[model samples]
Target: MSEDLQETGAGDRPGPVTATATPTVTDTTAATGRAYGGADPVPAASTAHVAGAGRALRGAATGGGRARRAMGRGRGRHRRTGRVTATDDRPATFRDVFGVAEYRALFGAAVLSWVGDYFAKVAVAFLVFSNTGSVLLSAIGFAISYLPWVAGGPVLAALAERYPYRRVMIICDVARMVMVGLMALPATPLPVLLLLLLGASLLTPPFQAARSAMVAQLLTGDRYVVGLSFQNMAGQSAQVAGYALGGVVAAIDPHAALVINAATYAASTLLLWRGVRPRPLPVVHTERRSLLRETFDGLGFVFGHRVMRPTAMVVFSVVGIIIVPEGLAAAWAPSFGGGSQVTGLLMAAPPIGAVLGAVVTRMTGPERRLRLLRPLLLAAPLLLVPVLAAPPFAVAFALVLLAAAAVNTVLVPLNGLFVQMLPNAYRARAFGIMQGGIQLTHAVAVLVAGALAERLPVPLVIGAWAVCGLLLMAVSVTTWPSRQVIAEEVARAAELNRAPEPEAPAPMPARPPVPAQPAMPARQPVPAQQVLPVPAQHAASQPVTT
Candidate 1:
């Protein structure tokens, strides 16, 4: 039994004392009856005992029950041992994520691919402009990479579930290598070049989906969030590296840059084929549904689920608005008497800020990051509102960098939450859907912003659009799901993922056959007649007795 005694003093006389006796391993609370560390309460009984002279005098000086209650408020109690426990508040580290070999390989492959992609984008844009001499065609070429996502990204991503992840990635890489190599040839027509680019871009969604699904498999728990941060950081760094070098390389010769891009794809394919292990597809052959059905199902699942619905809304809205700055950079920079050099710097600012934001977010714990989500969303568009004043190029650049940082801060936590909310089986399709939405939003934002900039000052167009974004954010914040709801969903999803998969049933044993019974012979009439003799004396005696 466990006992807690309370002594109260009133003048020289002690107030009625109380003693609570609880069974061993049962919870005990203070006189105030509040729970400590999620423990259950036990009943208390009043008891009187005379104290020695010294003890009585000491008891009369201090208020005992009230002091004990104050001390127990924040302490956690062990359910089994009834002991107080302290909470651990340490932050996560990069070692927690990058130490895994699989993640390292995936991360390396992604970096090579991202850098190659950006390089090719710049080269293709330069080639289109040089050949056609039309800015519109160049913009269209730049936009074509994103167009495939809007057209059939989800359907293509569903293919990831139908094949091995390694195979999907390698095939996509090889296809891109061949397509980019064709584009590098001098005799390739402009129309054919554009078509090849679109065809190569069409394979991107499945490749990315395969990579994402593999990530979910490689990293678990808190490491998943940290891994995602690292991936985002690497991608941003690659963009900076690729764009800076692409500009320099294209100046020498655009064809050379295209050739280099094709080489990167070949290198990426080799790396993935050698370094990454092959894994079975997420959906088994017997269990697989049609691509269209799965695509629609993924869409329905994201929009119809309560937690995911709000998360999707928040991510899409924030991304749609934040991307506008980079999307409009080409037109926005020229307005300030700057050429391609200024445009490249403006384009690079957001990704640099994004890299910084990822590093900062990596140092924070999950709970703290989630708490910052709404605040960061509100800050992003508000930060961009200053562009309304028509600040100088340098001032506008700083403002945009800050705004991009805030937007990235929101994304890190939001993405972690969304991934946690999804079932593991649907991760690829869901990722494809989310990524496609981001690409489509970005494409539309750039096109619309560029068109509006033609009729108005670039600063005015960006600021007015930002103001509209702020209103949209307000609605998103107002409708944001409560933390408790999201936590419950995350916990439930985690539980489902942790549950072991059911094993196939064992086959039954075969049984032996029974022997057949023999048949009986029929009686003969001649044998019956031979046995039918009777005595005359016995018959006459029986008749007289009757």
Candidate 2:
């Protein structure tokens, strides 16, 4: 409980973390999936879905400690004996995250890779359109980039668990580089080029998963969250720049764009090889289960765990809801009498909002992030509900931007919480699932919103989508695991992840050995007040439960 509520400010986490690459036995149980025991699933909300989500928004700008406590009071009377002790309330700076040489290497590699991938999309589309002269084939050619992720991203990502993350990243980059190089040859048939494109795309999930999973290893604790914000901001910027550059470069010469993409991969491979240090595999596989089976296990673990499941659901729902506005931007722009330029601006709002949000989230201190987690989770979607009124274009754009920012705000620290609770063995797979879910959710949400727009006003459909998201988040909050449970789980995860790396490696230990902790057994649940430490005065007093 103490560790869970324990604040993480700048410079709090110790040591040079690179990635979880060593093999270790896991203690996770099939029954609980974590050290902490969970309570019942919370039902749908009552009382204005927890006091008119509108009312809660009024205090949105309040100090986190005060706002969180206020929200906590309104919810079930969960005990709060373990006082939160905040360290320095400072936000980690860009220089702080980029100070490490390894992170800087990764930063350059990731940005270049993203830019190359986007450039390839435009190049592929241009090639197909020029050759086949069919818009559908051209679209399909461009969309082939996402097919592998949608189909087998988790399985591919699980491969990263079997080896050092550095190795996985490097090998994937090299393979992509070679394939894209092959694609640059004019002698290659269109079908062959498409096949090569598919092959290259297939490697993306593992490479990305490996990079994402090892992030905590490069930067520890609060710094990791700050790093995440930087990555998000950079990725958004890269997307905008990539597409613009891709348009110009591909228009001038598609083959040249392909060469440039291939060159980026080569550059990325070199950076990873030279700058990133290799480590032993994080988890040793005691038994060799099929990769598909292990992938399912990862899914089951995420969906079955109480802490992870609700957060996952909330995240997916929020993502799906938020995407509706972007998906409908074209349709909605007509309603407010927008010119083509205004429509373009409306379409750009999501990414613009996301970039700005990342910057804001980066500047927030760690304590405030954790304190505001629950509220922002609820607030993100609630901000979108205002679209039902059919506001003017300016108001609509502002609402969308604010809502997107709220989502980014919730995600940064939420990711840190995930890092704290997840054992090293499951990190890569879980991240893969998360990444896939985001992509799939965006696609589905857009399809649904587009379908509904045909029958109803775009604003009404978007508003309804947001309402659903809010209600689902309400369910997540009500069913959220107790602080005691979360605390024990975090402490236990931290302990297991801190285990020293061993020489040689195995794919994965199906279940890691559970580290011994105070009252962590399935049969013995810790009392709320006794979860960890207490104030000197409060330690001597008797406990009360409501």
Candidate 3:
């Protein structure tokens, strides 16, 4: 069952909307209405039978007036289950998403958390270096925060599905608050301080996973996509702010910066505990599973499902190559005989382009944005082809900026489509898998690109890698799923949201015993009262037979 709500534009203007119910296929024939391998046409009588069955299925799923009543409430607030609200037409403005009370709280919490995380990153490096007088130890302290995400992120994120989202977030925040506060202590030893920081960092994966999963609940349709873009913008802004403030505070006293980080976590904890509503675990599986098993299940789901597989490949491939520019900026600038300021400019170029790209994409309507996805993917690597000649610093900056913009443009729609294809129960787990993959790929790309630059010019290495990226994108485009396939996946997701709880099995009726004869084929059961008729044309095109 599904319901669609269309908004004419951004504001208060009313628009005509239509709603419908759709079903997912349980078997091959159910979806296409054709035999597994045969081309035999379905009889007209069977077509009517299938149509009738569809109507019955819709009735059963909606439960008469109950599902409609739940939707009328607007927020789907009354329903405690994982049901998704209908997709809304028109792009959501900043006002539309931020207007929701829950989203406002989540957004604020994210801003605070991001700022605090960056602050701690800078402060810890300073603290470690100050105490140990070792640059290596200081670097390790800074890098430790990322290690947990690479090694244990999926396992940690699986924990989020075992408990309420609100609880997971609040607990993680509180734990981090205490740990960072301890790290701020004047007499804490460097070794112990690093250990405490590592402990705190371990909680970040599940905390982040919980927050990401909740975003889908707070905003629906295009608003969800827009919300994610806003998140990227916020993170970029926060990183800049945190680094600036952290330097000044650490100059005065590194402890002060650590204290500030602790305070931010405390504030985040309070915001989440008070602002976000408690939600039940989204997964409905009754059987028990280990965390490792659950993590692999998520990995399999992402790579195994057809729609998700292509989407994930596109994201991983694009990011794996485009991210080399930022990671190599420090080495690349000095090789050109440029100073610190030049390096800074090179470092800031990509995020600035990304922010602009996100803003532009957000303003465009969803359909147009999607239409641009393939073009942007193709443009990204092509833009970098000019770097093969080792252009001037200024020229290189412009090229990198343009390529970054194209990559960011592709990300917005692809992420939205990814979220649309995901089932509610798998949101957190899938997010964990994708995030982990991104971090791993970016790290590997940087290491490889850096090593290659030692033997060749930095420009040559970057250009050659991008050429490979273009080939990867070509293959991705060739294998990309059709629009119809994506639409069907989206429709099936909506149907899952509206699905009713499974009914208890009916008791078997008593019958007189019959003499055993040759075994007979068992017939599939049909819910006669619930089935709807299929159209003649549709039935002929796609036939269903038991």
Between prediction 2 and prediction 3, which has the larger lDDT?
A: 2
lDDT of each: 0.71, 0.74, 0.73
Worst 10 residues of 3 by lDDT: 1-10
RMSD of 2: 21.7
Q: What overall lDDT, based on C-alpha atoms, would model 1 receive against the true structure? A: 0.71
lDDT by residue (1-546, candidate 3, tens digit) is 000111100111111111432443211112112211123122111222334355555655869565444334333211342122222124568998798899999899989988888888998999888878999989999999998888988889888888888899999999999999999999988888889989999999999898988887777656776787778877888888888898888878988888998999999988988888887877667886999999999999889987789888889888887898888888789767898888888888888878878797678655446546667787899888888998999899998988988888778667766776678778899988888888888889999999998898888888998999998987777666643455455556655555366888998998889978988899768775654467888876666543
Candidate 3, residue 167: Cα displacement in angstroms equals 0.8
TM-score of 3: 0.77
Q: List, residue by residue over 112-171, the lDDT tens digit for candidate 2.
A: 999999999999999999999999999899989998888898988898888889999999
The sequence of per-residue lDDT tens digits that candidate 1 reaches over residues 128-171 is: 99998999999899889878799989889988877888899999
- In model 1, the runs with Cα more than 4 Å from the true position are 1-89, 285-289, 334-341, 499-546
Best by lDDT: 2
